[model samples]
Target: MSSSWPYPRWIAHRGAGKFAPENTLAAFRLGAAHGYRMFECDAKLSADGVLFLMHDTTLERTTSGRGTGGDQPWHALSLLDAGSWHSRAYAGEPLASLGNLARYCLRNGYFLNIEIKPTPGLEAQTGTAVAHAAARLWEGAAVPPLLTSFQPEALEAAQAAQPQLPRGLLLDSLWKGWLETGLTLDCTALVCNHALWDSSSVLQAKSAGFRCLSYTVNDEWAVQRLLDLGTDGIITDRIDLFAPGS
Candidate 1:
């Protein structure tokens, strides 16, 4: 990461960190209410080629809809109650398209970090579509959303589709040559599980010019530790625990 990068320190996970329906517009609003100015979300294309927010391979976990999310067309996916599973108060929360989410973020002046959660065998297509959509949506905005993915093929597709957009590589472990892989993809940051990061890892990533962002961190001690290491950002589920002004 550059010494003068302009990203916020705190990022909300899957919208409001599981308080609201993950990946729904309702979650984004809830997160904003909790003073989160930036949010992380998963993006994938439905069978009909429309981009929507979802973190799982199947709809069984998060939606009232049936079947694998990747196998459903946009029309079917849109009709699913993406929020009811979380809470009845959010019963009608519709699946959010990338275009819709981008518009919301731009209008509200919120930053976004979109994780390309492509379905198996659709990695390249999903990445290209999401990146292309983001580029078009944020064409005139002050800042475009950041893109990241665990799949290198997806990141490559995204990069090829929209060279101007910034990207990050998401990792769960410190595999051999992880740094090299990140560099190969021209990623601006390395997004990893919080537990996988340590002082040495942070220093190595920073020294190699990659911003370090740890995910799902909710503890105050963890936050302080990352800050002490000069981490670029922390993505957390506990939005109320680390408000923007706090």
Candidate 2:
């Protein structure tokens, strides 16, 4: 792994994961209040191609709206109650756009990791759009947001669209040609499930010119193991439990 990693060691997942509404601005604020400087969020396109923050393909789980999120235009999607599903405290929280998130992060001088979560068949298109939008949004910034995705096609499209922005390959398993794929895409980091990283996996990723990172690591043992393994970054849901910069 390179020694010049610029992001924080701890990143709040989906803006705070279970603490607030996943991928909503409220969750991001909660994560920030807990002292997290870096955050991870899922980005996908609306029917009209507006980039927005959301985790699921369907809105039923996290919002009051029904049907596929990508099937709806931004005007309609923006009106959905994204936070009420979590709790009444965050009721009426509108869906957050990529522009809104960019403004918030830039104002706070924070870092971001945006996962290119495309709706089913729109992976390549969504990836391209997100990359272009992010390039414009973060122009002239010192640290560009790290673009990551489990889909190679999405990452490939993002790379083709914005070569300057850093990218990472997210893996839940050590699939065939995983390392070769990361190398092919010119990924800056290899973000894997926390359990996937051992001494061997760490060495393999680091030796192949990619920083090692873990996702959704919440337990004390998982955090300690990654630290002991000398990983570069950790994405976690327990923002309240793990203090950033400690």
Candidate 3:
């Protein structure tokens, strides 16, 4: 048999995404119900160093709060209604911690892509905290998480904290020296905005021993394009629409 790639090619973005409050347990359940074996979520430290899930720095968009999420300790932040903003069906779902989500995924044998979304000016510290926490949480697992980040400092810190766990560098634009940066950071994958990939880009990355992944691809054309380029992973918000197993 061929070697087993630990991650699935299809990853559910922010759990089930628009179907539920992003970065909540409800979202993860929804994604799993839709047959996703792999999920992606943003992680950041609370004021007290608790690793919780929230995409934006502020809670205005995704939670029922008005200030910076990373500014509050878990005792306060954990109680905020992270779901009502999405829909009443999930009115009071609690903000989930990385440990909470980790238990669910580990028990069910699911894979994860943890994007290190640090608070402003805390990139390296946040990366170090999340990496250390993940290393502890996922101890003895068959496959570790694929840590990723757009911030170079965060990925660099993650590498320093836990070099054994694989990592990916997220990119929205193919900035100059991205290849060298990914190599320098020792990333196993390059996760990009879907439109960034083409024949040469994919070949260039693959030739350097890096897997190419794309994010938030919702349209059929985008999916087809990534498939054509032999992309390794496709992180999407359309878990309800995409057939994960197929």
- lDDT of the candidates, in the order given: 0.89, 0.93, 0.92
Higher-lDDT candidate of 2 and 3:
2
Which residue pairs collide in model 1, if any?
Answer: 1-209, 1-210, 1-211
Task: Kindly report which residue stretches of model 1 are placed more than 4 angstroms away from their true locations once superposed.
Answer: 1-4
Residue 115 in candidate 2, Cα distance off native in Å = 0.2
How many residue pairs clash per model? 3, 0, 0
Between prediction 1 and prediction 2, which has the larger lDDT?
A: 2
| Native-referenced Cα lDDT, model 1 | 0.89
In the range 23-87, model 2's lDDT, one tens digit per residue, is 88888999999999999999999999899999999999999999999999999999999988899
TM-score of 2: 0.98
Candidate with top TM-score is 2
Residue-level error in angstroms, candidate 2, position 32? 0.8
Comparing 1 and 2 on TM-score, the stronger one: 2
How should the candidates be ordered by TM-score, best one leading? 2, 3, 1
| TM per candidate | 0.96, 0.98, 0.97
Model 3, 164-237: lDDT tens digits are 88999999999999999999998999999989999989998988889889999998889988998899899998
